[model samples]
Target: MAELRLMKGNEAIAEAAIRCGCDGYFGYPITPQSEVLETLMARMPWDETGMVVLQAESELAAINMVYGGAGCGKKVMTSSSSPGISLKQEGITYIAGAELPCLVVNVVRGGPGLGTIQPAQSDYFQAVKGGGHGDYKLIVLAPASVQEMYDFVDLGFELAFKYRNPAMILSDGVIGQMMEKVQLGDYKPRLTNEEIIKRYGSWATTGKTADRKRNIITSLDLDAGSQEKFNIKLQNKYKEIQDKEVRFEKIACDDAEYLLVAYGSSSRVCQKAIDIARGKGIKVGLLRPITLFPYPSKAIQELLPQLKGILSVEMSAGQMVEDVRLAVNGKVNVEHFGRMGGVIPTPNEVVEALEEKFIKA
Candidate 1:
């Protein structure tokens, strides 16, 4: 049976990882996200489900550990905050280059460097626009509530392996530390080595046998032409993801004259803003993008006919707003409103920005 408990968002992520049969978790501690490591340590899934949990020496080590595990077709993941995630970018790119499936959870904080340990969505470009090198994309999921934080862990794994690429749960300190009631799923047994071999033998680094040649995992090519072909293949996969996997939610959009675009915790705030706007006879709605990379550009374009303008509300220095502008493509007025350095914008503030940008302007 499923269990219901009041768990912090970070704790819910850990609980969901264990319950979803994660083979291993390798992570280092960072504020707002440290509970993920702490909760996993307290739960000790190794004893219950034979899951392997380790406190890596650094974020670099943690991400490389994920690479090593995923190469062997294991369900692996890691968690960190801003600066820590920056340290792991090289390994993250290596994993992407190698086309390994894994999960990376970034409980984002403010920064271009170690800015603050508070909640912020300033990592939008890093998470969605490829912080690493070469050409690659991670399947990015933005969870707006605690329940979603719990749910997206398994969903992240599912998409990672399905696409044979990395996936990220891009959250912030607000969701990470906040406590909410979560319905935890039943425990799922970790996959045995034999099951892994059986499932991914064709591509994974399973053992060599007389009947089959050994599988090699790498992202290197001595020939430039060969590397170009490989890059093309990756681009094709990304195109497919864009087509089939764009996820979003539309609230009160049918009769809306203006739209507010936001994600994660900011979207939650915008919900309240929508109510306040509607109460004042303003027909405003929200378009919350759940998948950041496979963004809801089309959804924004679809609502263009009814909207007089669009405002993107976020906790950053206007990152996602660029994408919103591209999607609108000069068809309507688009603007950005945000707060940085860990300050969250309030509902009224959002409305004020909306009115100021679209109404008063």
Candidate 2:
């Protein structure tokens, strides 16, 4: 039986990493998400599950550590808030370019630069649209609840390894800090060297063996033509991911005339707004994208015929609204509603936005 426990989202992430057989965690302390590292330290996973948990001098060092561990075919991860995630962009780009498999968690706070420590979804663009400089994408998962915070750690690793790419948990400070009941699953053992070799030996930098040529891990190609080919390969991989991995949840969308699109903490708020709107006979529904990178674009497009309009509810200054618009393709009106700098908009406010944008308009 799964163990039921009251856990904060950040703590759930840490515990899930251990239980899911994560090989290593390297991170720096950042507000609203520091509990992730603190919980890992308190558990002493190195002693318990033989998972290597280390505190790095900075976020840069932490991400590079993940890059190094992932190059060795290990299930490594790191966690940070907005500013720290910014510091990690260069390394994240490198990890993507190298086609390394690892997980990154961004428990977002408000930011253009050190904006606020409170919960906000301002990092949606950074998380889904490649905050790093490069032609690359992270498999971004937005977890709305503590249970999902626990669940996506394992799922993130699975997806990361599936494509030999980096994955990110695009959470917010609210999800990171909120306490809720979580069903903790059983422990899974880390993959052994033989298993790693058997699975990833074709590309991973395991020790050179007589059966095959030495494996190389790098993100650089001096030849422009070769680099372009590599970029095309990456683009093809992203298209495959988009085709196969789009994940979302629709609530009361079947009969709705107005749609509200959201993810992470905002999705929960939207759910409440849905109920309130239905109470007022507004016929509002929510479309929550669980996979932000492989966004539910097709799903949104399919609902376009039924929806009078879409109000994108977020904790940012309207970042994800762009994707909603792109998916809608001017077929229907799409507007944005948000609260920034760590301010969370109430369900009432969202309903009001829905009324103003879709109902009254």
Task: Give the alpha carbon lDDT tens digit for every residue of 1-361 in model 2.
Answer: 7799999999999999999999999999999999999999999988988999999999999999999999999999999999999999999999999999999999999877878899999888888889889889999999999999999999999999999999999999999999999999999999998999999998888899899999999999999999999999999999999999999999999998999999999999999999999999998889999999999999999998888889999998999999999999999999999999999999999999988876676
Candidate 2 lDDT for residue 277: 92
lDDT for 219 (candidate 2) = 98
Clashes of 1: 0
Give the Cα error of residue 186 in candidate 1, in Å. Answer: 2.0
Which candidate tops lDDT? 2
Per-model CA lDDT versus the true structure? 0.94, 0.95
lDDT of 1 by residue, 1-361 (tens): 6678998999999999999999999999999899999999999998999899999999999999999999999999999999999999999999999999999999999887889998999999999999998888999999998999999999999999989999999999999999999998877788888899888888788778787788888888989999999999999999999999999999999999999999999999999999999998999999999999899999999999999999999999999999999899999999999999999999999999988988888
Model 1, residue 248: what's the lDDT? 99
Task: Assess every candidate by TM-score.
Answer: 0.99, 0.99
lDDT of 2 at 223: 100
